[model samples]
Each structure stands twice: as structure tokens, then as C-alpha cells.
Target: MRMCDRAGCDQPGNCPAPKSPNSPERWYFCERHAAEYNSNWNYFEGLDKEEASAREQAERAEGASYRQSSWNAWAGPGDGSRSRDELRALEVLELDPDADFDAVRKAWRSKAKLVHPDVRPGDEAAAKEFQKLQVAYEVLRAAEERRTWKGPEGTF
Candidate 1:
């Protein structure tokens, strides 16, 4: 016969373990205390309607951005290899309109490495393509720096 753990409750079998949200630890409460706790608990009492709505919107936007970023990372700049013909390889590899300078440089390096002719040896055409890749990387890199030092829509 285990006694209830709740203070002032000496009755046997009156205390049951209550679930805790923070961790695995459980607290035992008598029936009366449990009801009182439940009644007083308010999950959203501190937040006003506007604050709650803003939080919901921010969460949704963050999810959408994550999904878009993942799709862009996996699809690899639309070089016409797929059914959709929306973006050119250069356009896809170009600095994103919202990207900061560091991100732009990182993206340029990654894409340029893939198309570098030294990687595919023994082909003149591949070398020419590599030259084009180098030019594109340089252009984007310069543009990114200019944009960072200047403002949005700034040209190199």
C-alpha cells in the first residue's frame, strides 16, 4: 500500500503519477490537487492574439524557406538535364538575390569546381566550358562584393 506523495494526502492509492512536459521525471498528485492544477494551467495565457499569430506565421515561413533551400541544394541549378526548362545553369548558380557575400562566394566555388576542365581532362570543348564557368564565377563573385559594399541591386 503505497501512500500518496502529495502533501496532506494520507490516503492510499489517491496519488497517481502526472506527466511532465519538461523531462521524464513524473510528479505524483492526489485527485483533488490534480484537478486544481489542471484548472489553473494556462498554456497560452501570456501571449496576446497578435503575438500568437505572428509566431505561427514566422514558423510557417521558416518551414517554407527550409523546403526551398533543400530543393535548390538537391536539384543543382537547372542545367536543362530535367523536364523543366525554367532556369539556365548560370542563372541557377548565380548568387541568390537575397544571399550575402559569403554565401555567394561559397556557391560560386562549388559550381565552378564541378565544371572546371582540368577535372575532365583531354577535351578542348570541356576546357572552353571550364573557361565559361570561370568567367561566371568571377562575375558573380564581383557582383556579390559590390552588392555587399553598396546596396541591393548594385552592379559590379
Candidate 2:
């Protein structure tokens, strides 16, 4: 069974949270503890108002471009079940939201090959696209792994 990370909280830790901003590591907590942990989060803790605003604007702009692409693949098992980042990753790979891991793998490989730095040597644009594809694949792969994982026992 997956026990909560919080000491003494003998509950199923179904909610997964990042250990820190921009970190791949995670902390598993019960629903209540997860809510409590999130309530106190400060996404821009150290940044000044201007810096925070700038960061927010940059993020919005980046997000807007994705929306502008008119790619909404949420039709099937992934309808509202996937995260925003997952949808974005699907868009990056030109895939449908319900695409299985095998499909994702194929899409990523085919697309990645075209923009791979080695294949498109010295092409800055291709390199940038390649990096984006890499991150997208990583996100989808992690999500798929999470979906297929079955806790030790009594965790459900």
C-alpha cells in the first residue's frame, strides 16, 4: 500500500505532488494533506511583483500559442481525464489525446527524428523543436507509467 508521506497519517496517498518547483521528484500525500500542502504554495515566492508579472505574462503567451494552434485532441479515454500539459504534449506530437503509449512512442520517434539535432545539424529551429518534443515525450511517458502502476496493496 502507498502510505501518505506525512508522518503518522495512515491514509492512502493517492495525490501526487512535486517535491519542489520545477523538480521531477514527487511526494505522495492523502487528499486532505495534499490540499493543505497546496493551499500554502507560493509559485512566485522569491520574485518581485514585476518579475512575477513578467513570468505570468510569458507563461500566458506561451499557452496562448498552443490554444491558437486549434489542437484539441480530447475525444475518448482522455476526455477531461488528462492534464493540460498532457494535452499540450499530444499537440506537440500531433497525436490524439486517447493515443496509447505505443502510439505516443511512435509519434514521438517519428517526429523527433525529423527535428533531431543530429539530423538537422546546426538548425537552431530544429534543435528547439527537438527539445520540445523530448520534454513532451517525457511527460507522456511519466503519465502513462503512473496510470499503469498498481500500488503494493490496500492503496485503492
Candidate 3:
């Protein structure tokens, strides 16, 4: 009988969770610990919106090609163009799903100014909201940059 991978647990290791996204390695845990690990895990921890979108597209392309999909169908974000994080960012800035990058920048500047730590000194709640807005803006900006990047002009 295999022992649970979680420290100090003597339960039988029956459930498996990937140690990291796209990794073959797994953590064998009892059912409870597996749930705990999954709840705490961020499957897209290091991925930006653009990377996520690309990955989703590739998966869909593979599906369209009728390849043996070991991973099953993907539950993509809204309209299959934006990532969940990007959607959340749009919500933060009160923008529509198809809003342009310029709109994102304008909204970010307007909202960030209201909750900025420098403007509202000593207010923990405002500081936290400001930080949230900053992260949302960054995610949107990076996605926009990625969308516009043209690498090396198609070398022959």
C-alpha cells in the first residue's frame, strides 16, 4: 500500500494530482488532501493571458483535426478570445469583452487614480484595491502587447 505524499498523513495514497501543469509528475494523496492541494493550486500560475489563449487555440485546433484528445474538451473563457483573468480585468475596469486595449489603458488610469496608495495614504482597503487594479491593468497590457507583437517580419 502506498503512503500519502502529504506530510504527517498516514492515509492510503489513492488520489493523484499533477505536481505542476503539463508535468508528468504527480502527488499521490488521500482524497481529502488531494482536494486541498487542488483547491490551493493555480493551474495557470505562470501563464499570461496570451499564452493561455494560444494554448487554448492549439487544443481546439487539435480537436478540429480529430486527433485523439486525451485531455477532452477545453472550457474556454468568454467568446473564446479572452482568458479568465483577462475577463476579470475587464470587469474590474467596467469594460465590455471586446473593448480595445486603448480603452483598457484609459479605464485603468482613471480607476487606479481613485484608489492609489499615494492618493489615499494609510487606507489599507484602498491600497489593496489599487494593487488589484494594477495587476488587472498589467494582465490586459501584456495581452495587448502579445497580440500586436510581430517577430522578425517572417524570415525567409
Candidate with best lDDT: 2
Which should have the higher lDDT, number 2 or number 3?
2
Angstrom error at residue 52, model 2? 30
For model 1, residues 10-82, the per-residue Cα lDDT tens digits are: 7663555546545665566667776776787665567999988898888888798655443344333333222
lDDT of 2 by residue, 51-99 (tens): 9999999999888755433333223436566789999999999998778
Better of 2 and 3 by TM-score: 3
Tell me the number of clashing residue pairs for each predicted model.
0, 1, 0
Off by over 4 Å in 2: 1-76, 153-156
Positional deviation of 15 in candidate 3, in angstroms? 30
Which ten-residue region of model 2 has the weakest summed lDDT? 68-77
Q: Candidate 3, clashing residue pairs?
A: none
Whole-structure CA lDDT of model 2: 0.85
Residues 1-156 of candidate 3 have per-residue lDDT tens digits of: 998999999999999888878899988999999989988887557899999889889888877633311112132223456778899999988998878788889999999999998899999999999988999999988876655555586311
lDDT of 3 at 129: 93
Residue pairs with colliding backbones in model 1 are: none
Model 2 steric clash pairs: 1-153
How many clashing residue pairs are found in candidate 2?
1
